[model samples]
Target: MKLYKVDAIVLRSREMRDADRILTLLSRQKGKIKAVAHGVNKPSSRKRGAVQPFCYSSFLLYRGRELDSVNQCEGIEAFSGLRADLDRISYASYLAELTDSASMEDQIDGEAFFLLLTILHLISRDGADVELLTRSFEIRLLDIAGLRPHLDNCVGCGVPVESETVGFSSSTGGVVCGRCSGIAGDVKFFPRGTVEILKLLLKWDLKKTERIKVPPRVRQQLRQIMQNYISYHLEKKLATALFLEKLYYHY
Candidate 1:
């Protein structure tokens, strides 16, 4: 058996037979790995906290023909802030799921790994704006996946979008001008302010997002547009996203 060490974030963990757990990890060394941690599900298991979702941990794994096995592990950051609150947990879960969707097995994406790690750290802190941070994560994640939607010019007409109102096409992955709105029936309209903020979200530093306070209307529009855009590319709605929606509706 070949042994290797990796520092990783647990993206997902599912219980297995007799205290075992199947873990999906996004590691610094290897992009995405599926491994099993024996006895981690048991109450007496020392590795319990380290194997949970959104945990950043260091693991010594034995490579097998089918799947890797966790031989030893230690928790680096359990993100207690995320675990302690339902809202934070939902947001963190969305980020984890998005990262898993964007990553590929055995392909190292240093930028993505660090982006997620940084965002996780930010969202885990006190008084963090989890919703805004999540939006930033969504846009950045799409860019890293090479699915960034064009915010500058019209995707259909090839002209600059200077109007007060513009349409967004998830299928085309960009904004559409009034003249090009006929290109798709699903094009959603956005105010120029919302569009500008979306552009800023793409270009601005993630940490500095707190300075820009968005109006409630614009925020709702931005959320809907990003959700639609992400869902189109991923070809399915994220479970965490739906949960968050219901979570939002209740509050």
Candidate 2:
């Protein structure tokens, strides 16, 4: 077995037999890896702090033929603020879920790795807007995964969308002009406000999203657009969405 080192963030973890845990990690060197961090559930285990979800750490791993084993881990950053609030946790879980679903095994996405790290840092800080961070991460991750939605001209008729309203076509995988929108069954229109937001999100870096203000109506519009865009591509329900619904809209 080859011993290798990687810097990664624990995305998710589930308890296993004998106080061990199976970790889903997004590694900087190796992309995504699942390794058994043995004995983490035990109180005396040194790996306890570093193996929890959202913990960023450097790991020494023993690479086997099929699955790897975590030999040692050194703690880096644990965003404890997520533990202090339900809303932050909800957004963090959604971010983790989206990253986990989009990532592939052994594909090194250094951009994506650092993107998650940056967002985690933003989430940990005081006065961070959860919606803004979440939306920024969503758009950036979509870009890294090569699922970037076209925000330039119309995807259908190749005309510039100069109207006050436009349609987002998941079928065309971008914006559709008003004239060609009705030709597709999956087109959804958004106002000029949401259209501008999409354009800004597509072009802005995540670090520049701090002072950006989005109204409640714009937030709702962006959420629906993101939901439709993701659902059109993934075609499956994200497990964290249910939790988010329970926390925010439901009692």
Candidate 3:
């Protein structure tokens, strides 16, 4: 069997046959790939820590026709903070799933690889704004996947929407001018500043997100807009997203 090495983050780990796991990994070199971790479920397996979801590790894999197999692995960072808190874990899982959903197998997405790595580090730190970070991730990931919403100009009329209020259409993929709002279905109207904030979230440095102060109302609006926008493009509600929603409402 041919062998290859890659540094990757475990996006998901699913139970397979006894003492084995099927892992979805996002690698810097190879994008997304699935592989089996034989015996990683056993109490004595050394790969246990490295194979868990959200662990960044170096993996030695034997290439198989259908799927790769983990030969040896070592954990680089366990992101222990995420595991320690329910909120962090939920948001982190959503991020991982979003990354996995947007990425294609064997396609090199260096940008997304680094984006997820950065987000994992940010969320793992104390006092991190997980909600804000997640909103940023959603917009940025959509952009990375070439599904960026039209923010600067109205999606329907091509007119720059500079009014205090504008309509956003998830189906139309961006903000709409007042005159064009009637053509879109399920339009949500909010302050134009909210649209500007979305633009900033897409272009601003992720590390500097803490500096921006968004009002509670704007935050809520952003969340709703992004949630709808992402679901429309992906064509399905993400499982982690549904779980996070329940977690939030239950609290």
lDDT of 1 at 85: 89
lDDT of 1 by residue, 1-251 (tens): 39999999999999878899999999999889999999987899999989989999999999999989999999999888888888889899999998898788899887888999999999888888888888888898889889999998999979999999989999988999999998988898889989899888887888877777988788889899999998888999989889889889443
Comparing 1 and 2 on TM-score, the stronger one:
1
Error of 3 at 243 (Å): 1.2
The TM-score of candidate 2 is: 0.95
Q: Write the per-residue lDDT of candidate 3 for residues 120-179, one digit (tens) a residue.
A: 999998888888899989888888889999998988889888989989999998988899
lDDT tens digits by residue: candidate 2, 100-192: 998998899999999999999988788888887887788889999999888768988888888888888876888888888886898888897
lDDT of 2: 0.86
How accurate locally, in lDDT, is each candidate?
A: 0.90, 0.86, 0.91
RMSD of 2: 1.6
Please give the lDDT score at residue 56 for candidate 3. Answer: 98
- Model 3 Cα displacement at 126 (Å)? 0.9
